[model samples]
Target: MSEEYYAARIPADIDRPDAVVARLTFRQVAIIAGTGAACWLIFTAVHRAAPHLPLAILLAPLVLALTVAAGIALGSRDGISADRFLLAAARHARRPRLMVHAPEGIPPMPSILPKAWRRAAGPRPAPLVLPAAGVDGAGVLDVREHGYAQIAACSTVNFALRTSGEQNALVTGFGRFLNSLSGPTQILVRTRRMDLTGLVADLEEAAGALPHPRLEDACRDHAAFLAHLSAHQQLLGRQVLLVAREPQAAAATDAGLRLSRRHAESGAVLAGAEVSVVPFTPAGAYGLLADAIANENPGGFQ
Candidate 1:
């Protein structure tokens, strides 16, 4: 490649990738961990009488190897990329683009750099690809997207009602919708445990104002309610699933609310592309979010 081409690419890490240098497979990691543990026990038990060898030398590699193995095993397979964030910054120029903070920060790009690459390097190098921008390891997806698609998280409806027919009808409608899709479609589901720290604080504050005897009763009731809620929540943490058709195959419709002509000046959906994330809930709520995405990005509706 020409020097100009090389200048455009992000510099590879000076250190070798853990996978390449350590020969540290997941199995090796497990072995290293176990070996270190065993070595520790052996050295501590025998080192007093057998002080001929420096035990640290034998164990140092084990510790170092174990740390690398742990990091490799835990790190995302795909590192952060810098395409979509750049595009959004160029296209709309008005929205808050989700981005992973670059290690060295976005740097300057040479004159030969592509517009996309230049955007990723605001002042330094932040690797971001548009397609992967909202992916798990890429930039966090902004809550909104322009032409690509639209999504909203709806609260889940509790299904513990006594009315069987109502539940059956709802499920039947959902099943029919799933069966109706033609071409490329995708569904995403998300769920999360609800946080009630503020609620807990409020309850504590209320209890503090009560008389001593009544406060005990309040505490007991609060504890019981909390336990009950926790048990129920543990069984039913939030989850959301996405169902979508490919942008090109989606039916025609108006786009979601773009931030603003002025605000959107900094961010734009280059194509019918978008990603939104919300805490997961039950299937019905997830289905509603799918509908919302389709509604917001009409052209992509299928």
Candidate 2:
């Protein structure tokens, strides 16, 4: 990546700062600007028409001030500049979850205008644009769940190369596994990217500290191998596959939670944790897969 692109990414050392943009909504800016313009125009006209009238001149400042104040007060719901930003805080907050690492000392985020909102009815919380809450681990909410299930995945296999006996065993085992399920299930896939800088970094030590010349070549190869892997990975997106079924549909039917089709034909609920069904990755689906390798001899390790 170019230096500019790297610089664009969030830096590792600095915590994301709170927003500083005090963007007045279109309505607020219009109201204030319009009122200020009108008041100033009127003040100018009055001064021109009544140049001898000291009293009218004396009231010009008050008129301009009142117009500006009214615009600010009415447009902003009475809060000063600070409260306007505070009202936007929720948008930056993420959804609440169970597994997120709640920092030990949840220091309140600082604000420049702590008391600004006392002046008006700032923007409603729902209207702000907010970043997503970035927590994904089993949230505190999930850990507290009354019941949950974990599943494993099965590896992809070249079944066509297997003997008839092996194929039959595999087919039979899969059929039996499918029959074992009962519950509501939802399949979820999580994907992410990783920085491979650490892997590439070991090259320096390999080059500098290794005593054996051959080992240095090996280290160079390792670094090149890692570089190739990183290049491929950069082009390849992460994929996590899950196959889930919800027995919860049946439970919901019996337990009487509102149900929707999991699919048009398959009978799944739109939601409700009770929607329980067994789920597994491809790797999770097949048992004895590792043991069933073609070359496994008596007492030989896989």
Candidate 3:
């Protein structure tokens, strides 16, 4: 494969600090220019009509401020200017080029705004599907609305600590495992900040339970040392996941049979690679999803 083919492709609309200046579209520029011209015309007409009036003099600064505000409002749509609001309004209009009406017979969606504002607001896009629902007995995950069932949770080997010969063997084994794969799979490696709350609590408990003063002092010192290390170090833990996906309707088949086959195949491949692997149980998979939703890291072996 070509290097360019494998290269990461960032979207054109991806936000960056310099994008505000660099990514000005034609619509954004038009909105800003139009607002400025309208404001200028209105200000000039008022000034010309009542040049000697005291009120006109006071209104000059106010008119200038209003012009600036209007320009800002019109230009600030979707990072560029207020053209986004105009586009949304245009799209939501009855005779829009493309109109997507709400489904019939269902209650209108709730909005945070008051009723009048809600009515004035443009139509919004439908909500996206949740990333995951829960896992099944076959260690497969029910990815709700995504039309896929997945099984995940795999372990890794410590490659850096291994000798040259061991590393070569590991590389060969991994290559073989990859070559043996017939279907699609996703391999994920995630690194998360380690939480030491439980360890600190355990250490405190152990320290309190010690009978001898010297031992208790020693335990306290050890706990304090651990606490210090936790505070100072950016301790990170890494998890490996191997996800096998099938159709959501595959649930109709025997779950045990499916899980056993997947487990046996993966186990044999990983065993040859000299890597420790464990499959998450249904409850474990659910817990993993829940933890991910809550943004909690619940593991060790850092």
Candidate 4:
């Protein structure tokens, strides 16, 4: 008998809205209905005011314009609806251009400063509200009312290169890990610019310690190649992070303990799939948070 393999296809847009009427989503239907209602109300009000007037001819242009506008708003470009794109554009225009780290809020200008000078200085910068309150010594994040969170760095697996049986085993083990989750868990994948300066320096330092001259030359040549690559080309490195969060409880200790246990269980389960998980230290966690925040806000925290 021959072995059989089956694959399931899942849509990328899992959260896409369901169609309610004529293949249109609820939001689209509401927009279209609301526009028609508004147009009808306008026509009725005008008709009541002037019973002898030619209502259809007078209101025809107004109604047509409104209908066209509604249709345009319903249309989507590049997978984004026109209405949503306009809303996002409006929000971007209204948001502050500059942001500063101020938990309490941006303070008012000192009374000592001249009114004209203060006016010329422009509006106060917006505050950068981060989710994390602080990181403790144990690498646990205090998220205020939200609760505590712990992060672990995870290594990737090359499933495409593995044999069919190995791939099935990996998938089964990963499924088991997902089934074991008891609380909120998040997997974040990001790419950052790669730096090879440290690697090049290490290679050069070890080259002199080689037993043979030929070996030393080869090491030096490899180090030079790495240095040239780093200097000439743009390189990026991928990072996979697992985040486990526990909601706030009466006892803070209990929340931390729960988060830690979840992290350990995740590591143990992922190990079956040949994924190594390493929990970040306090300093490492703080650094990661800072880098993430800096990326989001170009101005960075003050």
Question: How big is the positional error of residue 127 in model 4, measured in Å on the Cα after superposition?
Answer: 3.0
Give me the runs in candidate 3 sitting further than 4 Å from their true place.
Answer: 1-128, 144-147, 229-233, 252-256, 295-302
Backbone collision count in every prediction?
A: 53, 45, 7, 0
Q: Write model 3 residue lDDT over 1-302, tens digit each, in one string.
A: 32221224787856623324336445545555666677678777877887876866656776776666556544565565454566667777744343232333335667665888876766645432345654555566656554444555676788889766777777778877788775456788878789786898798899878889889899888888878989999998988877665544445255445545665687688787886557777767767675665535422101
Cα lDDT for residue 162, candidate 1: 26
Of 2 and 4, the candidate ranking higher by lDDT: 4
Best by TM-score: 4
User: What does candidate 1's lDDT look like per residue over 93-146, in tens digits?
Assistant: 654455443535555567897899878755442343232122111111222232
Descending-TM-score candidate ranking:
4, 3, 1, 2
lDDT of 2 by residue, 1-302 (tens): 32211113556736323432354445455556676777778767877887887966567676768665554434433344433544565555663332222334333334554656533534322321112221112110111123222332223445678666656555555444445444453444434455566777879565768888888888888888887888787633343333333322333232222212222112232112112332332233222222223223312211
Model 4, 1-302: lDDT tens digits are 54445567999977778889887888888888887788778778878888788967858876796777677657887888877877888999999899777767888899999999999999889997777878877888888788888899999999899877788879888988999999999999989888899999999999999999999999999999999999999999999999998875555577778878888898899899999888898889888988876565433322
- The C-alpha stretches of model 4 lying farther than 4 A from their native spots are 1-3, 44-81, 207-221, 295-302
Residue pairs with colliding backbones in model 4 are none
Which model, 2 or 3, shows the larger TM-score? 3
What are the root-mean-square deviations of the candidates from the true structure over C-alphas? 20.8, 19.7, 11.9, 3.7
Worst 10 residues of 1 by lDDT: 132-141
Q: Which ten residues in a row have the lowest lDDT in candidate 2?
A: 135-144
Q: Estimate each model's TM-score.
A: 0.31, 0.30, 0.54, 0.82
Over 4 Å off in model 1, which ranges?
A: 1-147, 155-167, 179-186, 209-217, 220-236, 241-253, 257-302
